[model samples]
Target: MASDHVAEFEAHRPRLFAVGYRLLGSAAEAEDLVQETFLRWNDADRDVVRTPAAWLTKVLTNLCLNRLASARSRREDYVGIWLPEPVMTDDSALGPLETAERRESVSLAMLVLMEKLTPVERAVFVLREAFGYRHREIAEILDITESNSQQVLRRAQAHLRERPRFDASGDQRRRIAELFLDAARGGDLPALERLLADDVVSSADGGGVAGAARNAIRGASRVARYFAGLLDVPLPGLELRVVELNGQPGILAVVGDALVSVTVVEVGDERVRRIYNVVNPDKLRFLAAQCGLVARNWRQVIEDTSGSVMELRAARFRE
Candidate 1:
């Protein structure tokens, strides 16, 4: 009986994590909620539980709603612009990214926009949009009427109506990221400006632990010059690479084995529309572990590399 319970929980672990992560936007917190859900599941009365999946979803979603309330309060005192904790999606850590909509649902841009939504609204939106939960199912999970669930989703969608959509193919995004990195490193403001949209916005979230811009930098020329100046300064042992972040092409900055920051670029109409730079050490913990940078000799791999910019794939990192 115990083994059967364990297997059942394991089967739903990935989906639970996926739902939790999208709701909270923090992998660490999502993991905590998932563990708590498992604990509850262990003690749950299986005889009365008609559907394990729905029961787990309700438990996890409630946990997230509680967390989101406190998280918003804490963010009031948070230092600088708080960006979502960046995660590598190549391994499907946050669930399937086979579709553009699924990928956008987890993007840093959409996550940031979601911050403006009420806890209930965010829950409804993520459930319906990301996971395809019906309004009736959402009502059950959220303990609201079906009509209320639909209304909440409408509000959430309206709030997120401005969310940027990336229509570029994966190869196109990678090529653009490569070009952006080269231009930034070489201090080529003209090239950078050419790639940026007229209203491009760049935000850096250092979370008060690392140096970053407190306010968002806007405009193509200003954002271009900012990156050019920032990346032109050479730091010994610093490496920049184009990698996949949250189902999109992004830049990872590292010095030795330590990850310095993750820059997630949003591309629209083949131009860079927004850049989210997360430099907070606390936010990097989960991703660093995923990349095997924790207590590993990954620095030796960097030392062997010839150039500052290269492709860092998941397999290469594990090797």
Candidate 2:
């Protein structure tokens, strides 16, 4: 019976892993957390655990909480702007839950904001809001008083509610994404200027190993001027390809034989709100396998973003 129960528990692994990934924002760490949860089950005296799922969740959440606490220093030292690991999936494979996760999961703004939350706070809120876990169930999983769980969730929600909701259904977003790609890759300054809002913000993450702009670029004119200078750099075989990132259209630059960088455009109505360039090799691990690479090298120059501006170079891994 115990063996049977354990097998049954394995069936929920994907859902649990997704939960952990959503909270922790790292696929590798999420896998570790789920494995640890099951390990506890294997070692436990079954007579004590009345609810197996609850027990698993409790173990997992606590383990993640500890990991998150210890992870602060490493994240602080992370190069440039840190972006979420991009999950590559064809649109057809999306189930309702997966769709929801992709929509909410990869939002750069949302992910950054989540960093402000304590691990327990994130756990409580995700359990309650995303998984429909009641406060009582959440309390059991978190090993906190039900009221405490409720309080924590409330505080977490309050912090997250301030960001403007992203609407993914608009055609303007897709159209603008295409326009931005044309402008950015073709070196059409006028086309790029027309697409960008007057007050646009651009940020890049190059892991500091590469010469990326140390600060965020604000205002449309500055970004335009910067990109104009960038396009002049000699990247002979590089081309822009459109793909969906964070549930929206994005552009990736394939340089020579490697996919070097990804550009995510956040659109507001018909205007471009934000441009995020991910040059940090550490953040692109999720795409490593897809790029047919064996190991990721953070220092190699895969794409040159700093043409004449500040001499920034971006790299991605190739097998």
Worst 10 residues of 2 by lDDT: 310-319
> What is candidate 2's lDDT per residue for 1-319, written digit by digit as tens?
8779778778768677767776787767877889888887788887998877777777888888888898777789886676565544344211133544446545565666788888888888767765779998888777789899889988998888755355645366778888887686678878888888898888877777555676889887788777765555555566677776656667766655566677788787577878777766556655545556322322354234324322432321111
Q: How far does residue 303 in candidate 1 sit from its true spot (Å)?
A: 18
Poorest stretch of ten by lDDT in candidate 1:
294-303
Q: How many clashing pairs per prediction, in order?
A: 0, 2
Which residue pairs of candidate 2 clash?
A: 293-319, 302-315
- Tell me the spans in candidate 1 whose CA falls farther than 4 Å from its real position: 295-319
Model 2: runs farther than 4 Å from truth?
Answer: 1-10, 45-50, 89-102, 168-171, 228-231, 255-257, 290-319
lDDT of 1 by residue, 66-128 (tens): 999999989999999999888999898888899989999999999999999999999999999
